[model samples]
Target: MVRYAQTDETRPADCVIVLGAGTWEGEVSPVFAERLRHALDLYRSGLAPKIILTGGLDPRNTVTDAEAARRWVEAEGIPAQDVFMEEKSRYTHENFLYAGEIMAKEGWDDALVVSDPLHMKRAMLCARDFGVTAYSSPTPTSMYRSTGAKAKFLVRETGCMIVYGVWRLFGVRS
Candidate 1:
């Protein structure tokens, strides 16, 4: 997990997949914004011709994370037609599954999966399970910059990964 987090396996792909992190008051959180920024960079660099934002409506937020991110990127000058949204995924695996539906519709076969470093390992696992050809492109910087914050995220991700592994073993896909 540590090794995967430290690496950036970004490459040219059919599209860029920006995993949804929670939004705050209808705006992208700093953590989510970092992911958006990295994906935007990848799009601008010609790595991909399109970006797919994934996230569903959280009960706490009025708008979905994908919608918020789409809005943010559009404001940053990305054309509306180039941005797609999977506005029904509430977690990592569903992110890929629903995004795959969009990919199929758009004839996109592969994607660069974008997320924070600590989240990449699990995100990639989910992407693979969902049968999406994905390459990792973790944010260059994380919102969890402090030692305590990083540790907390690591612990949480470790637990989440373990649970996901067990679920896979049982064929309990969501």
Candidate 2:
């Protein structure tokens, strides 16, 4: 896994929040698969017993990213009951909000938010806004190996962080 700066909080978390990376034909994209693989490692290490996959419906694939991830873990031997699939979020912020609510109900904290590096800042911000105590655990690698693709994601993520920073500052509820 891609190791960022660490602290005691990096110890075993209560849950692993695997953010979606889109799906195609009900299968996980390479980007999403990396997140799952890391999360699986965490689970096997006894870091967390539950994994929550967050995403909404994909018009073309006819299944949510959460479902696709849930299926992956189940196929990998994670019991179906241990996976929580949130199939209502259509965007990054919603991913935190919806999943945060579920976490609140379960009294979960210290959730590791898994996604690519560029996407982590905004995601962690959204997690705070949603009242979720989350920390980033970026995938060690991403499918976007091309320079153009990397630049595009970084720039877009910077813009999203700026926008979301303002949104959170204003205490907007969603």
Candidate 3:
């Protein structure tokens, strides 16, 4: 996880994918905000021509993560035409599944996957599983900055990776 987080594969792609974290009452969490910031930087640098925001509704919130992120990026002056939304996924796998569908419709086969540094491995795996040629572009500043917080997330990510591996072995698609 540490090795993958330290790598940045930012490059021109069909689009920039901003993976969703949870939001509260339509306000993006700090983690999600950082992902957006990185994605925006990539967009501004001309790495990609479009941005795809992936996230669905949370039970505790009135709006989906995609909606909240779309609002935030639009407020940052991203035009509506350059922003796409995948608002039916509630997890990382589903995020790419749904985003893959969007990419198919749009004729996009590659993407710059944006998310927290620790989350890049799984995010890239999901993207590849869903048929996207994914390049990692992790957020520069992760919310899990402290040693303890980073360690905790690392453990959680290890477990998640194991579970995803098992699911892949079983041919689970979502």
Most accurate candidate by lDDT: 1
TM, every model: 0.98, 0.88, 0.97
Q: In model 3, which regions exceed 4 Å deviation?
A: none
Q: Judged by TM-score relative to the true structure, which candidate is superior, 1 or 2?
A: 1
Tens-digit lDDT string for candidate 1 (6-53)? 778889999999999999999999999999999999999999999999
**Superior candidate under lDDT, 2 versus 3:** 3
Q: Model 1: which residue pairs collide?
A: none
lDDT of 2 by residue, 73-169 (tens): 9899998867898889887899988998888888887698888877776777688777788877776677778999988877777777777778778
lDDT against the true structure, each candidate: 0.94, 0.81, 0.92
Per-residue lDDT tens digits for candidate 3, residues 1-174, read: 778886789889989999998897789998899999999999999999999999999899999999999999999999999999999998899989999989999999799999988899898888888788889999988999899999999999999999999999998886
Clashing pairs in 2: none
Backbone clashes in model 3, listed as residue pairs: none
How close to the true structure is residue 56 of candidate 1, measured as C-alpha lDDT? 98
Q: How many backbone collisions does model 3 have? A: 0
TM-score of 2: 0.88
